[model samples]
Target: MLAIKGVSRRFGGKTAVADVNLEIAPGAFIGVIGRSGAGKSTLLRMLNRLVDPSEGTISFDGVDVTALRGQALRDWRARCAMIFQQFNLIGRLDVLTNVLMGRLNKVSTASAVLQLWGLEDKAMALAALEQFDIANLAGQRADSLSGGQQQRVAIARALVQEPSIILADEPIASLDPRNTKVVMDALLRINKHFGITVICNLHSLDLARGYCDRLIGMSAGRVVFDGAPAALTADAARDLYGLEAGEVMDADADVKWAGQARPASAAA
Candidate 1:
């Protein structure tokens, strides 16, 4: 459903993403994993046109995303929603109102402003909250909720747009282990049940292996590995992470949380 070819991004003389090519199929759950400064976030931003690539092309469902302008760009962005690591909720607005903000593209600015008084937009917003089990908090301010609740609220907001693809950049970076699992479960459920294409940037190899069907590992400013999670081995991970195989294997409990036994393909 999404294709990125020969995409590159540069900041002054340094390149952040170089010659990256990827194809994400419909209903696929793909994870982009790498160390800091590996260009994972830059690549994700380019996919949604949040950051214009310095070179090459990005197409979504056959339309050249780079070619869109004004209303066309706005519409394209609406179809491809993004979820940030930070909840990005409007602190003063009630949870429902914050979620309703997702539909601002579809409604006039005037109608959006008046949405707080239980209008048709309120109903639409409530429906979105219900999807994430946040309906009970509709009337409460977004800042009043816990981190997990806030993230769910953000996800509901993204869902309100009915996006065909969701780009989440380190969506669990701020959460605790429990909250991380909650957020990841919600994302996986969305992909499995609703068939929305999901591309997540994650730092945890185990989390990527556990939640994503395929993994894309980046090193420096280039894609070093792109394959099934089961295809990532200790040696391959060492190379991707730029460390000794044993060192990479022993780095974090979570990174090795999948189990003592490695997948047969990855073991090879």
Candidate 2:
């Protein structure tokens, strides 16, 4: 379990996140929804220690996240992987090489710097690519692929890390609708099939409703609502966004608001 207690983050004089507390069970697919500058990104960053909280504690199982340093912190980062909106791949590197970077923490610094991957490491990276149906693109440059394909490569890289948790910060924000579906489907598959806990920051309420098992609504750096998608009413959405939920409902026409059980085929 991931436990966050009274967490807060401050940048200069302004607070990015304030007094947040949450207990996330293992294997959960959680969607974090909020308007821009609502501290959604800050919250996720704090989990992986990319950004340290000014106050409170974050724990995974019994480990205290705040006190970790050096190699321990690096190990923690490997366990709690982060997926970014920009896909963060080395544009000039081949897809397979980029995926192999996930093993940096496990390998010696000299070997990693020299790019000396062994046959087993290469096989693991290839297997991760094949799991995402992108093994054929292993030899291709990461920048040469489409947005959806690049994102899949990013996911494959995360898979090679063998993370216990995945924190995606607005992962589909830059993609078109078709690419959005593809990336979201990949995340859903990772969460359901691998039993890895996923917490994604999303701009679209409909996508959150369709893909996430639980929705966490934030407003002005505070959590406003936490529950199932069906329980999030139009009024509650309005609280998150000044605009009514109806205006956003059409963003993804196929996503229903009634919180029906997502079909297995959706992830497949």
Candidate 3:
């Protein structure tokens, strides 16, 4: 569904992403992991044209995404929705209203500003909330919800757009363990049930291994590994993080928010 070839991004002299190549098939759940400055977020943003590549090309369903502009670009972005680490909801708006904002591209700016107060949009928004199990909070202000609830609402908002592909950049970064489970479960369920293509940037290897069908590891702005989650090893992880296998194993045995638990066979 998505293909990135020889993609590179530079901010002035600093290259955030370099010569990255990846292909995502329909209904695939792919996870990207890397250190703080490894360019995972930059790569995710480039998928939907949030950041145009400094060099190389990105294509979606065979259409060259970097070449898109004007209405064409907007239309393409609508098909590939993004979820941020922060739940980017309007604080004052009701949860349902915030979710309905996903449809803004389909409606006029005036209508969206007024929230298109009608039964149809309301029904669609409520259905989206129901999917995320936040239907009861539909009328409440976005700011009133807990972190987990807010994130679920944000997912609902993205789902409301009926996007063919979802790009989530550290979606569960701020949640506790239990909340992380809830959010990851929701994402997994969506991928399994709806067959939506999901590519997410995650910090935790455990979470990526547990939930994603495939993992892509990055270091210093380049992809170092791309394969099934089961293929990852302590040695590979050590190389990715520039640590010894023992050091990587010793630090934080407990699962971090998005961390994956090592499989029995791979455990040290």
Candidate 4:
């Protein structure tokens, strides 16, 4: 489990995340929801240590991850993989090679720099590709693939890391509705089958409601609501999303999607 205590992040004079506290349990699918500038991305980046907190600490299994540095930091990053809205693969690299980059944190610098992967590493990457049903595209360049294909490739890359936790920052924000379902279903499979804790930042309430067991709402950079998706009332959503709460509350109001009305787990 991971514990976030009074965590906050600021950029110059502006605060991006403020005094947020939450405990993330294992094998849980939790969605952080809010409109733009709500600090959801900042929260995930802090968890992955891509951005250091301005105050407070984040600990995993009783160790203060905020204090980790050098090799320890690298190792922690490998254990905590991140999936971004924009698929962050090297455009020039083949899909298989892009996925093998996940193993770089665990390999020697010489091997990594030379792109010399072991048979086992190649096999693992290939298997991850196959898991996402993208094995045939392994030889294709990342930039040449469609957006959905690229995102799946990104997910496969994250899977090859063998992470204990995955922090997805708007993984489906840029995809079409069909691709959105595909990506969300893929994340659900990862969380359920592999028992990896997945904390994702999402904008669509229907998608979040359908896939995530718990939903955490943010407003003005602080957590305002944290509970089950069904427990998230329209009133609470109003506080989370302001005028757009109507969209957040009514799943079918502005969007047409088959991803609504899924059951969620009991609150942790």
Each model's lDDT: 0.83, 0.89, 0.85, 0.89
Off by more than 4 A, model 1: 116-120, 244-268
Q: Which pairs clash inside model 1?
A: none
Off by over 4 Å in 3: 244-268
Question: Model 2: per-residue lDDT, tens digit, 1-268?
Answer: 9999999999999999999999999999999998889999999999999999999999999999999999999999999999999999999999999999988888998999999998989999999888888999999999999999999998888888899999999999899977887788889889989999999999888788778889898888899899988888777788778864565555454554245444353332
Tell me how candidate 3 scores on lDDT. 0.85
TM-score of 1: 0.89
Residue-wise lDDT of candidate 1 within 20-104, one digit each (tens)? 9888899888999888899999998887788999999999889999888899998888888999998899999888888888888
Instruction: Output candidate 3 Cα RMSD.
Output: 3.8
Give the Å shift of residue 29 in candidate 2: 0.4
Model 1 weakest 10-residue run by lDDT: 259-268
In model 4, the worst 10-residue window by lDDT is: 259-268
Candidate 4 lDDT tens digits, 1-268? 8999999999999999999999989999999999999999999999999999999999999999999999999999999999999999999999999999999987899999999999999999999988889999999999999889999999999999999999999999899967886788788879988999999999977667777889999988999889988888767777678899776565553244334533333212
User: Model 4, which residues run further than 4 Å from truth?
Assistant: 253-268
2 or 3: which has the higher TM-score?
2
